[model samples]
Structure formats: structure tokens, C-alpha cells
Target: MIREVQEKDYEIYMELTKEFYESDAVLHPIPESHRKAAWEEVMRSKDYVQAYILEEKEEPVGYGLVSKTFSQEAGGMVIWVEELYIRSAYRGLGLGKQFFSFVEREFSSMVSRLRLEVEPENQRAKELYEKIGYEILDYVQMVKERNAER
Candidate 1:
């Protein structure tokens, strides 16, 4: 079953986030303190940062986080899929697509576009994203780390 995340599910969400990041391509895990702060921000936001939990017999098995962001140039809301993951054992059963479809339907009224980023090395995830109609953004995402000492 899939449902919106509740405050009671915070621990499960944190566990899943940690497990997914540790097992996958995630470069850094959000510190416990930072995670708490970030989740507080999410909960307090007027526009929702919604999370969907997939459960089996009342235990959370997977989750996805979707949020809406308004585009100034486009003048419409964009649905950003911040994270999606299904436990390894539960993959290949179409749950991921179902999760995406749920997000599409839930935000259809507000969203003008759907957006997500996938690591180049994660071919499985890339294939799934493409299969669901997400195209690669042609521009490379460049970042410069600032040093406090500098």
C-alpha cells in the first residue's frame, strides 16, 4: 500500500534514507542533526514536500518524495521528484512506476512539468526514468565547493 508519510513514520523514513544512500550512489548521507532540521523545514512549508510510503503488512518497504516548485520563467508549478526508492527485493514488480504515476496524478492540477536527476552510472534508474518519459537535461550540473579557510 502507498500513503503519505506522517510524523510517526519519521524513523522509518530516516532508516530508509540511510539504507538507500549507503547502498546506492549517494555521495553523502545527511547527518542526523541536519536531517531533523531539514525535515522540520519540510513539514513547516506551506507548499508540501510530500512523501509516499510503500508498505507491506504495515511495515514501510519503500518511499518517494515529491515536491512542487514554481518556475519564474515558465510561470507554472514544476513537480520535482526529489527521491524514489524501492527496496531491492521489491523491485521489478512495477512499484516504481506506480509510485511515479501516483505522483503524476496527485500533482496533475498544479504541475506543468515533472523533473528528476539520475546519476549517469545508475543505468537501471536511468532506464526507468526514461521509460517513464523523463528526458535528460542537456546541460551539465556544475558545482564549486567553497572552502571556509579561503
Candidate 2:
């Protein structure tokens, strides 16, 4: 089951996010302070961020984070899925598909498209994303650090 994340779910969010960042799928560790601050911002900005707790039998199994921005190419708002992590043991149970379906149903009317980034080495995740109708773009994605240190 999927439910909107609540203040009481903070511990689970932190634990799952730690596991995700520590996994081989991630390229490097993001600073703990940055993660905490981002989570706090998500909780505070409901209009800009949408997060949900993925549960099984009413217990936390994973979580997802989504944010929106205007896109001229998309002709309006586009949703970016920043994180979607399911417990290693609970993978391959179609939870990822369910999560995508839930999000699409919730935001399809407001956004022109949904986007996410996945590590090239994580073929399993890539396949799941493709099955859910996401396609690889020909252009490369790049990021430029505006601050020398943060």
C-alpha cells in the first residue's frame, strides 16, 4: 500500500534513505546534513514536493520522492522522481510498478511528463522503468556544481 508520508514516518525515511545511498547502485555518498535538510524541505513544501511511504502489511517497505518544475519542452510542469528505493529483500514483487502507477494516477493531470535517473549498472531497475513506459533519451544529462563546497 502507498500512503502520504507523515511526520511520524521520519525515522523510516531516514533509515531507508541511508540504505539507498550506501548501496552499490549509488555513485557516492551525499552528506548527511544535505539529506536531512532536503527531507525537511520536502516535508515543509507540500506544493513543490510530493513524497509517499510504500508499505506492506502496514509496515514501511520503501519510499518515493517527487518534485516539479516547469518545462518548455513538455509544455508545462514536469515531475522528477528523485528517489524510489525498495528494500532489497522485497524487490521483484511488482511494488515498483505499483508505485509508478500510483504516482501517474495522482499527478498525470498536472504534469506533462515524469522523469527519473538510474545508474547504468543497475539493469534491473532500468528494465523495470522501461516496463513502466519510461524511455531513454538520446541526450546526456549533466549537472554543474554552482558552489565550490557545500
Compute each candidate's TM-score over C-alphas. 0.86, 0.94
Query: What is the RMSD, in Å, between candidate 2 and the native fold over all Cα?
Result: 1.3
Clashes of 1: 0
lDDT of 1 by residue, 1-150 (tens): 789877888898888877776766565655566556546756676375777788867778898877778887657998889888888888898888888888888888877889887777889989999998988878787878653222
Candidate 2 stretches greater than 4 Å from native: 147-150
Distance from true location, Cα of 2 in model 2, Å:
0.7
Colliding pairs, model 1: none
lDDT of 2 by residue, 65-105 (tens): 88888999989999998889999888888889999999899
After best superposition, candidate 1 residue 84: deviation in angstroms? 0.7
